[model samples]
Target: MTLTIFSFISFTGQKSKFSDIIKSKMYFKTKLKKIPLSLVKQENTFFYFTDENPYYFNLLKSSIAKLGILNPIMVQPFEKKYYRVISGFRRLQIAKELGFTFIPARILRENLSPSEILTAVLLSHPHPLSLTEKVRIVRIMKDLGISTSQICTRFGSFLEIQSPHLLEKYIRLSNYTPSVLSYISTHGLSLNQALAFENLSSEEQNLLISLGTCLSLKGYDFCNILKVLKEIETKEEKNVAAILKETEILNVSKDVKLTRSQKIDKIKKILKMKRYP
Candidate 1:
């Protein structure tokens, strides 16, 4: 198999600018070598805290088949015989499935700590990493005893997280129950929605999940309905299952003529009346 390698070129007047760019954390030595795919192990910190999305796997496969991997997978020596994958897990998986015996890989420098390796992987990823993947990175950083403030200072702006508390919120998601995580993943729940759902009792959550499945609510509608159910449960001292069956909330949700926004508004209004009356 032919190995693809990356290198930096110096332009006449752009030399200084390129040098400065290389000095930034975002720039790394891109040179790569082709190594036996079987020698590389998927032992990166990212594998621990999140599940892979099969949809993304297929997308990656198609991209690789057409365009080939634009970036080299990062790896480091491990156990003196094997290399550990630091980033590009999905790409590696797809490459193997495509019957590639050897893969392009960049070997990370020696003596880096786990946190540093994790940081390098995060900064070097070619594709935009998912929020859940990032959360798992932060959780690992936390496990390595990095302070929340330090993490924010280093990655907050890049990850678009505004505050240390907000970063903490993402990290906490790693500790949510498996069923809840599965629900969040399968339904494509946003971070805000997951955070809201995380606060409910397991029973309340299961009922809400059932309600979503039953009504065939999609995307934001499912989240909004859950939020409404949560509000009514809090104020009216009722369970979600009871509210769905005993009240007209589910009926509002299933109404064919109402737009999704209208349904959300109606559900909120009905919940308010239940709380007040």
Candidate 2:
């Protein structure tokens, strides 16, 4: 048997070549048919963004606003000159809002590979990320010799949940109005904050978002404010003015649990330290 095995090994230039062929036959096969932009079609392309697309939205509207547009919205070109946006709805709307006529897009030139389809998916959706996620993304992009945009387009954006406490706020906003998500996307609402509002009961979120709907009321952190509103039975009972006064929290306060009487003492102690220390 040993002599036979040696003969077989000698007959083959390299045993590894046989193994490679077998291994290659069992791999996954997924590819996109890259139809030309003219072949592909576009319809109803300019829709306001929705919260449902967890892949496209990020935590900070400010970041998106600051970054401007890095990647052009993707579209399948159809009928020669027209095309449908396969991804980047938010980008398209913002560009429209920002006043631009022609947006950048990629038309299919050849049959897309499985990897290319996956890359398009990665581009379209990004996961929520925290500061650490951003760092990890940067590192991965560096190691892979790719840009953040490329990685994001190929892989979903992985985000860290930065603020859990304000989840209800996002929910409330969504409940308050249908346009709440778009408002958050357009305004400077944070992703965690938007998600927080989204978590609220539909009715409650709509109510809260409606109340906070002015274009000027951009930074609507919903949690405590919504709580204060709910604490009062009716909108009339919710002294909106007085609540706004209380809405201001010293962001750097040392929070401590205390009974009513203990709370009084704690405040006194805080004041003394503030004045003296």
Candidate 3:
């Protein structure tokens, strides 16, 4: 993708809060000034490609087509005339598609480690991870021999996690089917939402994919969630059958008639309407 430059919204707006989050999470609280998009730069080493990444070419094309770069991309200064994308692969790709020569970016200094840069990028430009992204981050960390504590520390604090146990489930998601994983990515499913599919058989995982959609239980609380789900497995095949009985809502309840297509429809409808009703 090419570089882009669009209007920069303030840090108080919904679009702006993520930039604030990046500042708060990274503990880098400078007066974040809004600048014209022209000063922003793009770097070459910011992304590693795989056909598997949803932020690959197609979605990148679509995001640019629809959002018109709704969110500013992240960047780190490189040399005299370039910036690296810490995140916002879609924005970058779209910029290229839209024929933009420059894009909005947050300029970071040249000397940050990969993890630091990623953490900065996440803090600066978070997309509220799909279960797949969260799992991928966990896997990325473990494979690279990076500790969660370090990621947590650099990202700001491990304490901010509402469900720390999610770290465990995230690492395990790599074991699942690619199709199953794609369902999460396609739907913007979060770690918590993915747990709704957990303790489920492969067949159940498929069912949950159909049931959950891009709406229902956008994500789950992996820590408190899976723990309670494990405890609720009073039947054979806790991996599958257990979810047939009870369901965790906020890691609190295990009883809900969420089966059947109609019920799934209702669940998805209610997901965004209320606060975990």
**Predicted structure with the largest lDDT when compared to the true one:** 1
Ranking by lDDT: 1, 3, 2
* TM agreement with the true structure for every prediction: 0.67, 0.35, 0.45
Q: For residues 1-277, what per-residue lDDT tens digits would candidate 3 score against the true structure? A: 0000011221122344445545552433233433334545554443332225645667767766776665666666556654555666656666765777666555555665565555554444434544465565556556656665544443212213324464566656756676777766765656556555555677656645544442243455222333343444433235533353344322222225444444544433333232233
Worst 10 residues of 1 by lDDT: 1-10
Worst 10 residues of 3 by lDDT: 1-10
Candidate 2 error regions (>4 Å): 1-41, 44-73, 77-82, 87-105, 109-118, 121-178, 195-201, 218-221, 233-277
lDDT score for residue 140 of model 3? 56
RMSD of 2: 16.2
- Alpha carbon lDDT of each predicted model: 0.65, 0.40, 0.49
Candidate 3 ranges with C-alpha deviation above 4 Å: 1-70, 77-80, 148-165, 175-179, 187-277
Candidate closest to the true structure, highest TM-score: 1
lDDT of 2 at 85: 66
